[model samples]
Target chain A: MKSGTWRISGRETSSLPLFNTEVMGVAARRTRGRRFWSNLVNGPAARYLFILPTILFILIFLGYPLVQSIYISFTDASLLRPDVNHVGLKNYAQLLSDRLFWLSLRHSFQLTFTAVALQAILGLGLAVLLNQKVPGIQIFRNIALVTWVIPIAATVVLFSFAATPEYGLFNVLLKQIGLGDLQRYWFGNRDTAMWMIILMHVWRNAPFYALALLAAMQAIPQTLYEAAQVDGANAWTRFWVITFPYIRYTLGVMIVLHVIFTFNNFEFVFLSTGGGPVRATEVLPTYIFEQSWQYYRLGYAAAIGVAMMLILLTITLISVRLMERARRS
Target chain B: MTMRKIGYYSAVYILLILSFAFLLVPIIWVFLASLTEPRQITSGSLWPGLRSLTLDSYRRTLGSADVRIHLRNSFVIASMTTIATLLIATLAAYSTSRFARISGASITVVVLSQMFPYVLLMIPFYQLALQFNALDSYASIVFTHVVVALPFSFWMLKSYFDNVPRDLDEAALIDGCNYISLLYRVILPCAAPGLVVVAFFAFVSSWGEYMFASILSQSKQTATITVLLQGYISGRRIEWGLVSASTILSIAPTVILFALTQRWLVAGLMSGAVKE
Candidate 1:
């Protein structure tokens, strides 16, 4: 009976080997074709192919434009004149002596710093408030986020209405609160024009900072706070020691991003004031736009654009390095 | 101590509510202005009374043929831009996430693209459009919108893809699936939430975009709602009611979209911040 079983097992084993060899033969034949196709589709070439579309689009839209902008900054080109001539450093030289350019730069700095500073402070406070485990906090948070979600154009229009000299919301609210003496054309007054623009900017953007900082605040471990409390650390001390360290990275990134955005913010200033009231609110972007489109001074605008790019690039590099250093420690 | 804690909580809640009110008052004011009569809007009333409010502004703004054309143009351009951005960003993100050879270069390119002042590109883009006779066409507007939306979408999706487990890819491959099928069947399903967030972002960015849309499209035939809104503001006779109504209309879609996708949008933005 054992020999009969062995004979049966031997036949099974021999047939299995024969079957395996047949399968291997087929697989070997198929692998050659599969290998070629896979190499073509899934190899190094494939990576380039996958990224080719994005790269091509960027090159055409972003890279080409950037190069052309730089080139135009060195030439005398205007929309009105068809003929273009290369003029080395003339636009840059003119910009150095241009009072409007200096004034615009100063206004851009003033607006960006003030708005970003206010946003960071208010946003941090709001974030901490929302971080509490109170009921209906989500609703409050959503209401705050509404400003961020609203279109900038809509915000501009609404605020423009609010800032009108007579019968506007700002003046109305002030009068209701017994400050009617301060009622005036918010955007028409040169002194208040930049401030109104800055206020609008802060209103539109502070919610973004609040949301971002709230996320960072939520990520802080509960254990740290508990341990700090046990160690007799007061609220202020605990915040300085624990919360500040945790959110510093996010804060740094937010500040840099906000600065870049506010520096180049054309739409807000353009739509609201049009850098008006004698260019009181004119920043680098609006100035560039006015030069290019309104005045048809393409070369001069391109030079300003180049200058803006350099400033932005330097700030970005410095901020990135600072962030990397912070991450390391 | 319990009394003190309750007092503290109350103070915090009060402050939070006040901050929320400050943020919401502008939006509420705008809504009220939109509903009020044109003359009543300038009456300096804190809140317009029921007698002062009317739906006529909505009727008039929505009824206008010019407004309708502008709205349609905005929607078509934004939707086309969103679709094109998603398609290109998805493929590029997949490649960057899956392959090591091109990932670093691609990421660097995306980051660098973000730093370029978009104002600098406007002139060259306009010139190029003029050269190609692409002005007043959806093609030019949509193309620029896609360019603006692609870099961030690529980064967001790439980060999401990074979080997806690689085991699924290998398992699918062992099951005899090719790369393309693997993406559609495995990676895409896993990354569906990320894709939705990217799509929402693309749609909103294009929908609210003002710069290129205003520059590239000149005539009312091709102008976006934003351009039209600007026109209303800059016109000789400013109709406050109609302007307010159009403002609300232009913002309504985004507001509704935000309310619906608030959770995902918040999550996506938080992840982006943390990752950065």
Candidate 2:
């Protein structure tokens, strides 16, 4: 049978709305089941399904290589060898004293920081200036994007030639303009080579940041600007109070993305100088290449690769966290 | 708000024009240098003596020193990779957009993969290539290039697919259309512009790629245009005429493509960033 009714103190259960309560409970359970099914059958369900192939593609083709590289970092693997020996921290320990490795690491950091900072600053400036509604403005904006669109290899070669010390156009132009002292081996001198790399990086990458920021700027509702103006805010005040806060998140994302791109860049430096003039321009990636391919030190190169990955992973994590926080706040 | 306004507008215009000049200078220099004779280029003057302008540099660069082979290789590799990337990326994007519940994990994988930055993997990829006896082959470069381009293309196409209305698919299905026809007849047409954008990006990216080409392609038979240009620049002595001329030629296609798709490119990028 069923459970007994309550005593007089808590009785009157039968007098309660038992039918309604039971009906409501059953409806709630049914609604939960329908929700689960709807999520499985919705448009986003298709998106989730389609995305799986991409995930698998990246994992097998790219992820596997990354894991393999990390593993090789701890082993004595060479290009010519058929087998790898577990060397534990030997490769890492050797890297500690490797002068060239240190130099390359220094160069990578210098180049990454300099290029990213300059790019952000210039990009921000351009984005702000271009955000104004001026006539024939789209034409100027298009021209600004030219550098970013052109193939990097082409720019690298062109700049290398243009900045050439002897017969380069820049030198000739300077000499003609009476700045005869301004000309020197642009990509040849150790002191100037890294600067040239940073400059080229800035020139090529600044447009991308500008474009991203401009998009973010355009997304801000115009009503806010009108409200700011009504409150007696000047252009500068309006930007500082309204525009900056809205796009700050986009700026952070751009910075992180550019840092990754700049740190991993090898094309321009390699094309221009080949980490030359006595390895002065040798960034980490180039150093890895030299070790593995040029010197056949595959194991040591893998170690360098692992270290670069760790640094990049750390940067990426911090970037993602900042991005998430920015979104939330 | 009268004459003062005119003056301010003119000043802004002038500043923008100057910035454009800076942007165009390097490319203009290449074009001008390409037209100049070696003798004039050596003199380092912008005004190539009208009399000194010649096609000699172009002829020399395109000559049988195997420049043609490199051009062909570049075309074959870039085109093949583009096709492969579009095929794989489209399918994956379709599956993702049509079926996936949360793109959180998938998008993360794609973004992180991109974060790896091809440079870090160069050594290991090379070692693997050698192990598989795939080094120095066009297929090797193509396979590697596919990997390089797939992530970006997938991300791009997926975002594009997201813009399509779900009702389009549902309507097609209701009208007795299968998934294949729905994709081909309806969704593909809808996503045409985005597909073009993705394909062009993949093509240019593969074409301009230098590091892997330098490492993997052993001879002129497998060389791409970028590597050839690098060789000209880095030889025992610089061939300024050939280097500058070839550089101009190499950039011409991309420049023209960007110019043609200028409007679409801006719109595509803007939409992708903000919406997705």
Top candidate (TM-score): 1
- Model 1 lDDT per residue over B133-239, tens place: 99999999999999999998988888888788887876675565555767789989998888888888888889888999898997987799999988888776678
**Highest-scoring model, lDDT:** 1
- All candidates: DockQ: 0.51, 0.30
User: What tens-digit string does per-residue lDDT give for candidate 1 at A11-89?
Assistant: 2223222212233334434676865665555444665577788889999998888888889999999989999999999
For candidate 2, the docking band is acceptable
Q: What C-alpha lDDT, on a 0 to 100 scale, does residue A201 get in candidate 2?
A: 88
Q: What DockQ does predicted model 1 obtain?
A: 0.51
Clashing residue pair totals per candidate (backbone < 3 A): 0, 16
> Residue by residue across B1-276, what tens digits does model 2's lDDT show?
699788878877876767666678888888888888987888866687789999998988878567778888988998998898888888787776775444687667766776675775676567678988988888888878888888767777778888898878766654544345567788889998888888878888888888888888988888899888887777888778888777887887777878877766765765554343
Worst 10 residues of 1 chain B by lDDT: B170-179
Q: Interface RMSD, candidate 2?
A: 8.7
Indicate the worst ten consecutive residues by lDDT in candidate 2 chain B: B173-182
